[model samples]
Target: WTILRTRLGWSRQRPARRAVERDEDAIVAWRENEWPRIKK
Candidate 1:
């Protein structure tokens, strides 16, 4: 892992895991609309 990180610039961090019960449409809507409003 250390060799890969140094030689290949690879990361050791784990990828994010989505919840099994997550709602795709809700997530999309939040990203499209609600997130922009919240960011302001």
Candidate 2:
């Protein structure tokens, strides 16, 4: 793995996988509305 990454410059990081039952709408709302409030 180290040799492949060093020689080939291949990334070992995997893509994030969301749950099948994840709420897209709620996540969007939280990011848009709630995140700004908490960020301050």
Candidate 3:
């Protein structure tokens, strides 16, 4: 269990949640930009 914990600690340094949030923001921004254009 100690070895597993140590390995997990080292492997979990990246910001996964931030990456997902960024992707969601980008998709929202894209949809917002497209909505007005589609009406014309």
Segments of candidate 2 deviating more than 4 angstroms: 1-16
| lDDT tens readout by residue for model 1, 1-40 | 8999999999878749978999999989889998898898
How well does model 2 score by local distance difference test?
0.93
What lDDT does the true structure give each of the candidates?
Answer: 0.89, 0.93, 0.70
Clashes of each: 0, 0, 0
Tell me the TM-score of each prediction against the true structure.
0.48, 0.53, 0.32
Better of 2 and 3 by lDDT: 2
RMSD of each candidate relative to the true structure: 6.3, 6.0, 11.0
Better of 1 and 3 by lDDT: 1
Scored by lDDT, the top model is 2
Please provide, for model 3 over 6-25, each residue's C-alpha lDDT reduced to its tens digit, 9 standing for 90 to 100: 97664435654555435776
What's the best-to-worst order under TM-score?
Answer: 2, 1, 3
